[model samples]
Target chain A: MTLLITIFAAVICTVIWYKTAPKNEMKVGILCWMYWGASLMWFVDAIIEYAELGAEFFTPETADMINDSYLGLSVVALGLIIWLVILLVSDPKGVVRAALTNKK
Target chain B: MACFLIPAAEAVITTVAAKIIKAKEEKDNGNLSLTDIKTDDTPKLTFSRKLGWLNKLLWGGSALLAFEHIWHGEVVPYFPFLTAVQEGETAAMLAEMGSAGVLMAVLITTVWLGMLGVSYIIEKRPDKASDTAEETQ
Candidate 1:
């Protein structure tokens, strides 16, 4: 269920972003980050849950590898959050202007 | 699963058929004008407007649902069956939490649909007013 919802969200958001976004590179980049970051986070959580459900099927080596990389996902998530914050707060006027001008 | 897989399979077939048709057409016609294929439902975004409370309602609801699942089912189970886990002594707890998650999803979807309806109404209002003004003129 989570996988379905996340995939739907990712595809819809990507299409919406691509269709509606202005020609500005920086703004487009920020929006892409926001969409993909959210999708990535959701995907990871869904995968982890599904993995836990089928843990018996996994080899001990595979389980160990997953456990070792747990912190890496968190780090990436944190970085995305920080990037989102920067996009929201710093030089926000440009974003606001771009958004407003985009209304057709 | 059948409900899910059928549409996905249909989409794949449709896309492949469309590509084949387009390729055959291009081979026969030499060139096709892209502008003739433009869609009318393209999104028009206004930068001056923000989703405001509606955004909060939908996103906040999603966050709440996630929190509810984690806290009640995974972190701390207030009830063994409905809230904690899906089977055995905790089955009831799991069921309850699952119901809550479904409720949250419904609420979020309702709020979004309502917002879309409101936007449509609001956008229509200006056109109506303009029509009236033009009629008066």
Candidate 2:
């Protein structure tokens, strides 16, 4: 469940990053890499668990899947949080810089 | 088992490597300053910055997986830390780590290498653009 969510987010971000490759103000590339890395991590876990649990892996408990989905959402949110911090620190678009300078 | 540990371990190594390389680069190149002059060649991204991308990917991914493991109760706060390891399934855990962990680490590194290659091409674009501009003139 988490794997599905992460993969979806990764794909969406990758498309956006590709479209804005020329002048990427948001640094969507970082977001893309983060999400893709996570997607791969989950993919590997899913494969391994499937190998171990065989058919049982496919039939996860309903409540467990829901909880995993929530965790997936949290992971996406955390990635965005990290990206926000990076943007603030790097200020690639200089929005923060402009605002700070304007205040002075 | 705790396969994510492998990437977590790699994150630690790469983080240290980034710091070391960054220090060396600073000593070699000094501070960066903006200039209005345009030249035949100017790199937009540094080697350290590229490696920083890989480091961030590894660290962020590992942290998320670690959290997931904890959420599933595969990881515990007590000694041994991992429930499987604590249950005396050391052999199985080690096997899983050896196979799955290595594969995951290698897979991520391969992706990062491909990214570096793509970025290299992107970095060369300005030179290509200038060359075309000159040819047009």
For model 2, the stretches where C-alpha displacement exceeds 4 angstroms are A18-29, A50-67, A84-104, B30-39, B124-128
| Superposed Cα deviation of residue A12, candidate 2 (Å) | 2.5
lDDT per residue (tens digit) for residues A22-76 in model 1: 6543343443333333343334444545566676424346655554244334333
Task: List the candidate 1 regions with Cα displacement exceeding 4 Å.
Answer: A1-91, A94-104, B1-58, B64-83, B86-90, B127-137
Expressed as tens digits, the lDDT of each residue in A24-72 for candidate 2 is 8988887887888778888888887899999999999999899889999
Model 1 Cα lDDT, one tens digit per residue, B24-113:
655554575221232243333231122322333333223323432453344333543232343443555445434433343344335446
Task: Return the top candidate by lDDT.
Answer: 2
TM-score of each: 0.30, 0.76
Q: Pull out the clashing pairs in model 2.
A: none
Q: Cα miss at A62, model 1 (Å)?
A: 50
